[model samples]
Target: MVTLLEHCRIGPPSAAAEVSLPVTFFDMIWLYFHPIQRLLFYEFSCSNSHFLETIVPNLKASLSLTLKHFTPLAGNLVHPLIGSSKPVFQYKPGDSVSLTTAEANEAFDFNYLTGNQPRDSDDFYGFVPELPPEKIELDSKIIPLLALQVTLFPNAGICIGFTNHHSIGDASSIVGFIKAWSSVTKFVGDEQFLSGNSLPFYDRSVIKDPSGLATKFWNQMSIFKIESLPLNFPTNKVRATYILLESDIKKLKDLVIFKRPTLVHASSFTVTTAYVWTCLVKATAATTGDETDGEGTEYFAFAVDARRRLNPPAPPTYFGNCLGLVYTESTHEQLKGNDGFLIAAELIGELISKKVNNKEEILKDAENWISYFGELLNERISGVAGSPKFDLYDIDYGWGNPKKFESVSIDGDGSMSLCKSREFEGGLEIGLSLSKPKMDAFAPIFFGGLHADDSMPINPKENF
Candidate 1:
């Protein structure tokens, strides 16, 4: 419906080269292919059933008033393969959490957090039909483009959603900006935005020197194909989730502790991924038709931050695509032998370490990985499964750390998302996602192991 009178215009949208999403412009164009990245993680914890009554309007006003503050990078939200990728000013109210408010409370128990269907397209950024010219500001609801999605569930809980493409800012920056908007709208402080310092430059040239530590680290790592082998059922599979915690993390360390004969205890990232994978392997076996044969293949993948490996590593805030995927592969029979948890955990840790320890490998394999990911993306677009998933969302902003944060999946695709929960009563939060069936299987295994520690006194009604 764009007209000559339109003040803003973007070219027709398509994955083709009508417009190139250069590495420099990756943040903006990513939302076109991976729009979910543009979503804001919201947690509405209110006592009164009228949470939305107090929150939604405040969120709307904050976004509207803060329009000018929305960066071109953050403001860019695109729908893939459509015309003139305009921002959808409307918000589509998301349905309530997968489980009932009560059942959910009984589960992980978020103290009865709740919300209902999403509202208008203006509130939620609508899908674009295609990619368009880069750098064009959207002309949806606001000139600067701000979207307010309201999800009012049955309970008093509500979520005020906002999405600004990464081109405008990254997770940290968005957090700062959101805090600013919340401050103004809710009558709070603006320190969030005030304290945010820009990240270092985006120069990959630092990695140019292969002999340097950065390239050495890359040389050792192998980016292998990762997939979930059915631990038990034809349908059973472990979805991706990057989570870690203090207590169980200790348990993991304890299991791998020993001498040179001692296991190669991996970092929390490696152990946790393996822990989840083993849990999946074990749980699926529990649910299998033949409980005895534990020798099925179980697998998962994780990415390492290569920024620091560069001659100088990209600054923490340098942002964009700074991750490289590393995977772990093995059979269920192998995982089930003795302590599958320990074995899987060790393998993940050793593999990641080997890759990270050798810096020279990266420079040599940089282009190879780029090409690998490119092919991977093509496969994903073609609906092929097993695309690598990344999780760097467990960041704590001075808030206490989360025990475990994960995103639940939707759509039939295996894509995952979720948030990490703070160990303390109310610490910082983490968000992530995953597909449903896999999530259902994973939740049980995690609780079976994690809930073993009864000290937390989690609310009886709160769902995981």
Candidate 2:
């Protein structure tokens, strides 16, 4: 159902500007990893003439200019010799990015794009472009850092897909690039379009690894032969987006507070994460028990952005990964019990509070924790990806905001993606990945917990 229209190279619209930047400690953490990919679908019922004549050209041209500022993106991640050192981000005069254009055979379905119902993962793959392989050099390996695809669904809509090397930057850096590109597209002729914008800071020295956690991270990565991300081929797994409205979040918060009055920092992130973790655990228990005993350990891992949390805070524009992971544990029996909700919330809250209050201590200990965290992730750990803070729906690229935004790659990693509700009401959108059987069991439990009466007392026997 997807047809490729064209595959073209988009280099810096300007003359070749050769540049070489050292991959700092923070950047090294993501080396040898598959690039992160995301897709944004937008429904535009405009005439084909308007789209081809106006939108397409404008988008491609604007992206070219945007890359001029984000020069590193137009380059590659080059690995040094075997006996040499770590990889470095290299940009030569002839460096460029691949941009593919495609067309869908059928009309776009609004419901299918944004619905909560589970759908086949294969439905999304066609829109995503493949990540290019490394261009072998005698002394080094050159890997393309970014690839983009734009697909049109005829009189229905258009989808913009982005695939970027994780080592180039984190979510903040990627999102910033998209925002900048959109800004340029909006004001195509305005020379001042990028004047007031937040330019990317390519210098990775801002992220100070006092404990040399980056080297530890690299050593551990070398220990495992990590796999590449899945292309939009076919998948047996399914994905769905669930929304938690403001009212529903309030009730959940109130429920947790009532059960454990001593709980602190029961914010939206903590509470919502707890609810999802509990549902997954209960669902897994109902179908295929991952644990040998009725009481198995369940881990909840969440990524914390260390930009502002660092002792010598990193610049908002600082490029590369500046994130720390926090993994908390709970037991299946504890989560399935009536008081399980509060128990999970307390653990998540306490960790956040500690990280916020004791940034120095946490950063100091991150080196030792890197290997341990990686091992936990290798297990049955449920972590979160994408933050509501990104406000994905707000991405207006000439054509209005995206109709649906999803972190499609989360499927292979078994992590959930969170985004702010598009309705403007304070809410959260969670993109969860699970087998069909597990999803069926999780749906009712998740909905029922939300609709539970406010005055309902914590009954230990009810859940048991």
Candidate 3:
């Protein structure tokens, strides 16, 4: 059980009225109604009275100061009544972000928090905030852009969780916000220190839509009337974190090269994604009691950052959504076969190479990509979320670096979150969600595959 200690609203330290900012083409793609929640857990080996006396007060104050610049985070998102008009993010005076402070009834050890293995899915939900959509009336309803919750585990630890609407911003923007908050929290008295930090760049005009992909994207999404997801915790679901050492990644790449010597550009991202894809499918087959040579289909998808991929790239600080959903399809047999990892690697490698090198290609096919994702919306698909490049672990809020960081929302989408290893240098950490039975079957295969020898069977690459 989780006990809500208090509920309050945190607004900017000062009043500011900002214009109704237009949502960019990139933002329009993700206007679908959903809250993306993530959490950072911190453990302090001190008395409960010490934690509440010292940390809570500073955390609340710094959060308020942080909101001074991040007013949009405290604001709400609004859409036009006309179907053709794109939605805009609006910040009204006196508006603020909802914050809740809570205490958990269950006790979990630091090993459970720090270990890279599965935990009871229910254990973490107490930390997540309920980001309810706003509904003033039939036409003029406002959806809260962000909400936060901080939970105390007595003397054991504390967890800071945030829930934000995807339409408000992408992962980068969210991380940027956290970094700013942490900076402010660290240098609470130094206004100059806060001024020197990176502020959010909210100029949506920088996004150009020559292909009219925004309208196409919005229309594609509008076709499907998605119901708001319930606030229920997942049942019988388990989450685990696994680390792939830098050496392991290199070995995997080398193994791929040994099989396909000409594949020089096979990357760490490609091989790691391929390895996960193969493991997931095999695990799925085993958990569900599917035959070894099952004939159905499986799919893998991931978001591609288009900030630099576009023709005239958006600024590094350009806020709002700037990701394109990219996915590949495969047969169950192909992915579960002996050459599964190799085949998966080639497909992922070729696609990534094209995306990174041939920027114009994605721009040209932006419309098609939107349509393609629409079709997959109702299908059973698995994909990857979060990236090691984001440096999620570095988000330190005064006390120390977070003991663990989780993209909790990904559990709903059945996708894995990838981050750089916290303990091991040059290693990749994967966050996975599966039913207990599947996880029981998955652990051995996942770990054993890491130690598997070279000389696995191969299937020739057909697409590349």
lDDT of each: 0.38, 0.77, 0.76
Candidate 3 — worst ten consecutive residues by lDDT sum? 455-464
- Candidate 2 lDDT over 1-464, as tens digits, reads 78887788888866858878877656665675566879998877756677668777888898889888888899988886676377778888768889998887755464586556787776777787777877789788888888999888777788899988888888998998888888888778426455765888776667676676656666766664234455344567688878887767787788778876777777899898988888888788777764535566788887778888887888888767777767789888888777677788888888877764467655756665545664675666788888878888888877798888878878777888998987647988888877888888887777767656655333322221
Q: Which rank order by TM-score, best down to worst?
A: 2, 3, 1
Residue-level error in angstroms, candidate 1, position 256: 0.9
Q: Per lDDT, what order, best first?
A: 2, 3, 1
lDDT of 1: 0.38
What TM-score, to 2 decimals, does candidate 1 have? 0.55
Tens digits of per-residue lDDT, candidate 3, 1-464, equal 78888888888776576647887767766666457889888765545566568777887888888877778888888876555666778887788888898877656565586555778777777788987667774565577888899888777777899999888888888888888788778777537435765667777767887767777766776664332355465557888887777777888898888887766468878898899889888898887777644666677888877788776888777677888767777888888888988988887887777765577666666677656766675665778878878887787777688888887876677788888777778888888878888888877777667667753322112100
Rate residue 409 of model 2 by lDDT: 75
Q: How many pairs of residues in model 2 come into backbone collision?
A: 1
* lDDT score for residue 291 of model 1: 64
Pairs of residues clashing in candidate 2: 125-232
User: Per-residue alpha-carbon lDDT of model 1 for 202-282, expressed as tens digits?
Assistant: 343433433343332233222332222221222233333333445555555655664124455455555555655666565
- Model 3 segments beyond 4 Å from truth? 81-83, 189-197, 225-234, 291-293, 454-464
Model 1 bad stretches (over 4 Å): 1-21, 24-33, 37-70, 74-148, 152-155, 162-192, 198-245, 259-265, 286-297, 357-364, 370-420, 423-464
